[model samples]
Target: MDMQDIENKYNKLIIRIPVFLGLALALGIGIGFMISIPRKNTVSEQSSKITEVLSLIQNNYVDSLGLDSTANFAIQKMLQNLDPHSSYFPSDDAPLAKSQLETDFEGVGIEYEWVKDTLFVLYPAKNGPADKAGVLAGDKVIAINNENLAANTTQNTLFKKLRGKKGTSVELTILRGKNIQKISVIRDKIRSYSVYAYAINSEIGFIKVSKFAEKTDLEFTEALKKLVEKDKVKKIIIDLRDNGGGFMDRATKIADEFLEAGNMIVYTKGKHKRYDQEYLATKGGIFEKGDVVLLIDEGSASASEILAGALQDNDRAILIGRRSYGKGLVQVPFELSDGAEMRLTVSKYYSPSGRCIQRDYKNGKPYDKNLVERYKNGELLHEDSIHYDSKQVFKTKKGKKVYGGGGISPDYFIPLDTTDLSTSILNLMRENKLREHASLFAKNNKKILIEMGLDKFDKGWQIEINTFRNIVGNISMNTTQSDYLKLYYKSYLAKVLWGNEAQIQIRNTQDKAVLKALEVLK
Candidate 1:
């Protein structure tokens, strides 16, 4: 196209080219938008279909159906498909679920055990409703509110009868020896402890954390203060075995107590940016300088794993016991319009070493029977049986090798103690014979136990072999098993006389995990 005459034509052609390109791009954009609309509509349509079906069933069904219950069940099933941890709680169960992690609850406040289908009071909470109404330990509860407790009556039924709104009263028919008495107890708020601390020795402290509740961090801080300042303990053993876990914040706060400032304890990532969070340790840690030995087992999950992972990744504590429960997902509770609750898994947390604690559940694995599977695979008895993801290996702050793909593995592995757990022992435990015997013994020696006191009783008390033989009957056991049974009976007697702390202390005298922790601390 050359020179002055072609230049004018070329300019016009270039201008037309720009308009042509704009039209082509617009057409492509329109097609893209058309393709994306169906994906959005598909989700909307599926949701509408569920609602339509529910409405149809509610309006035109032959028999009247509780739509509320149906909807709750449907929601629960849908959440189950998402993950094992996400769950839906009905209105009636919602409060009970939330109350588990609360510091206080309204009830008559008596810890009881079912022996041979009869409920026997282990002990009443001091100054609580049952205690104030003269509900003595070792008394048999025969009826509640005049409703006789049949042999088939479930403990849950009795639990419901005992728990009611604050300031309400319940009548309990108690049988003590040959006499039956009716006692009325007014329900009141009863305080609960998540943290239990005692001196393991003059220089070592033992703290058992049952769960990470709303007041867990505060309670732990108080226990830490008493151990460090009052008891002059330089070493601490934190027992997290059987702690199913509760609040993440509570666990992180406790972890912060042992971590230095500016350290990253854990971090979480999710689908939404708002759910992404990084937890860092703050200043003024209470037990930062002490030697810490953390004990965990298969029952420890969620917040317990977070605490263990933090301490392990930072190389701040020596972990002892079997591998913990693998639950790295973080759930956020949502209150429904009908007063129900939905706990939805929002995020997956990672330790400071960049290892995700969640196990493989999407690969056709049975998530609910994980512990059973672990036992079958011999992971509990042998540390070498544990399957580690070689691809998920990560390094701790101190350059220690740690693995992901599942729970936090302890530095020192202690196999599960199945010794002394014979068939006879199991049968005795199943029938609650030991507890029944202990209750009877405590009832007969109530005056003696009170007068002797816990300290003296702990020092000089022993369940006679003949007394144990009477409870055993024809059930045969070796010396070791017999000794273990006798020790457990003594512990139960301590429980009936004193409380849970006394029982724990007496049991710890020969507990394998506690002994291992002591060895590690030493």
Candidate 2:
């Protein structure tokens, strides 16, 4: 054939496909289509198929699967990848954790500590059921309701035994000064104080709250009355370091005492919203007009932010300390189908002046690393080193400029004091050697330590340096030490055994932030 005729024949052959051969190929394609998913479908269909495969394994696999736990764990992993603060508390942990942030819990009304295997009574709240029944400190718990305590019983186990619904009776067999006696006590609502008010030298009223709980407002009022009116306290120093956060309502209640009514305390909003919801100060305050100073540091967050923000904004209180840990998300608890709950961030909380004290949290980026970044940038060391992004500025009612998208900046930046810190102390603390040493010290000198009052122990006490040295000498490590480290360890051990307040007293002596706050009040 000629070249043109051959080309025409080739085109016709391609179209025909040998008739029967083409029919067989088409039949095979149709059969494959009947069994397999179409390639033209969206990617979602492929994901659904993979999910179904996993579900099958979870349901009818050879081994029984913990499907709920697996799913929650997966969710937790996903959230962790987002931010450190975005944590998932499972059903078992949620109640216990939530109680600490709230006002009260159902438990026997007594504070106790475990020394070795014995439980030592610390303090009983005044008018509390335990106190009414005459439970005192230094008393030891030997048994509960005639049941001999299991050998090496942990404090947590003891707590589980003691804590129950109100009106429930828990019998405690006590060992008091070599005398054993059994006492039946009624379980009641244990109200934890958010504000502890006392006078320092009859002049400065000290109110140190660990966090803002549900009953913080009422507690604050009672505390203020006891401190200011009853004790005749003049200036107030509110310490809020290491207080991560709690109820915002309680924060506003505390702030209202310092701020006049109608002042905007804080605001909140999200992406879909335009104008923010503002929380303002209402009527009725315990100390509507008083000289107040607030203490803050890197650990202060959320509700702590609200109180600090309001106090700072209203100029009613002088904020003295380092910058706070900015965490401005407001979380709401939602229960899953499995009784497990998730504290989902509902909105971004803003200070009264429209400053969102939440630092940037972008997807796939590190959030907790901000503190390290701040330290490297010298923000922890000096106020001058703090540079604000001009674009994220907000102004207080008084027109004082404040920055958003970060934590609340203290009016007075107190540099972190590492003067007393040493490699020896840090190592001991991290390794829990100090705790062990405290236990030993308590066992040996229980009576002698008890005789020494907290005040006397705090003032004249020196940690048994030789004992500490002997312990440290036994430790197999190469770490430098200082005179302060040796003495500090001794003091810390004494504090842990003698009383928890002892450590605070010792730490207060060297805490630059506390001193700075005191100076501001003065």
Candidate 3:
């Protein structure tokens, strides 16, 4: 073949193998395959050597090993040694892993909390198996099929017992108030909402994006319109505190709703030119000019940073909270014929300010370890504690300074409030049957509470000490002077009476980070 033929062949090869990474689509989750077959001779030689090694091991090794399993293990380790984010998922696990970032999953459909090694139902998914079976929130799960789990149980065990092939059934015993009853539920797929929106007050709209799932942007649009109609909301807060991230497309679409057309939302770069891409905001945003604030913390990463950094860089919103979880590398998925998948890092995503928010990985420390080190180094507690390479600094559109090689530093840093964790009453609340108490309270007064609505419930809600004593059977544990018990109590009632959504709005009324956002809006 002539030189022209060689170039044509190369172009065809590149086109056949699509670049796997979609910017921030799965920062920490994306993967791409890079197999360079350098001129034919070297390629054949290396391929033969690898094949020979595998053959020798399979035939001559003393220990017997399954060829497919051994090959998969080697592939996984090879990806791991390359970077922290690259991962391999087996055939059985790949689908489940994908569903986690999506909106729904097959299960019993109940939000639950563990207390004292016992499982307690929080809020059953609407129309879900648990709800259909009359499983109410606060029902303490004592046993599965008469196999008592209260003594030796874990989240995994609970999940194993509660979830199964859709349309299957499981037996459970629940303790509701003074009554214990048995219930059987058929497992089915459950919808997991990513966007939670509510009016914080008449003036401030609160929108919490749990993760940038496929439907998040659509959910957010509907929410924005409702807020716009609700007496003209003056300020909006987008909460991404613990949102690790999901689809980059969803995040960028949401960001577009707050930015003018022609404005850059984010961009990505990798070693290969094909990996370069840029996203820009389109025209006609619902709240493009409205005052906005983004709430972030150590858990905000990837798509979270994409939205916050875009807004902050464009001078469209104020970031209020702790520093974000730094995750800038992008990956793309390469599916194996065995139904397994390998996610390979392909590029680094840059915030609108031109900062790649990935923290240093040169030391090969895991992200979890890095977080622990941050706490030890006083970085999370103090802004001055943040150490970054001065040379990696970048400027936002409005001339504000930003740094790379770490995460996005909030414009207004708020120290985490750990008082609740240490508060005896709070610990007691978590460890005790608070969920059951909430459930019973809502059940007993459902008619009256429903009529009251969230507004009236918040204003006139009362949890008498006598009532509290009755709920816990007057079980005393610890005392706290914190004074948040009232709100906590009310929020639970709201959850049981209405739904999980209503409960969050009520709880946000007292959330410290949320309060800080409101103050900033003021």
The numbered model that scores best in TM-score is 1
* Model 1 local distance difference test score: 0.79
What's the TM for model 3?
A: 0.83
Judged by whole-model lDDT over C-alpha atoms, candidate 3 comes out at 0.75
lDDT of each residue in 461-499, candidate 2, tens digit only: 676657666666654333334445654665555554544
The lDDT ranking, best first, is 1, 3, 2
- lDDT string, candidate 1, 254-304, tens digits: 999999998998898887776678999999999888899999998777788
The candidate that achieves the highest lDDT relative to the unseen native structure:
1
Local distance difference test scores for all models: 0.79, 0.65, 0.75
- Positional deviation of 367 in candidate 3, in angstroms? 2.6
Candidate 3 backbone collisions, by pair: 30-331, 30-332, 31-331, 31-332, 31-343, 31-344, 32-344
Q: Between candidates 1 and 2, name the one with more favorable lDDT.
A: 1
Worst 10 residues of 3 by lDDT: 12-21
Candidate 3 deviation (Cα RMSD): 10.3
Greater lDDT among 1 and 3 belongs to 1
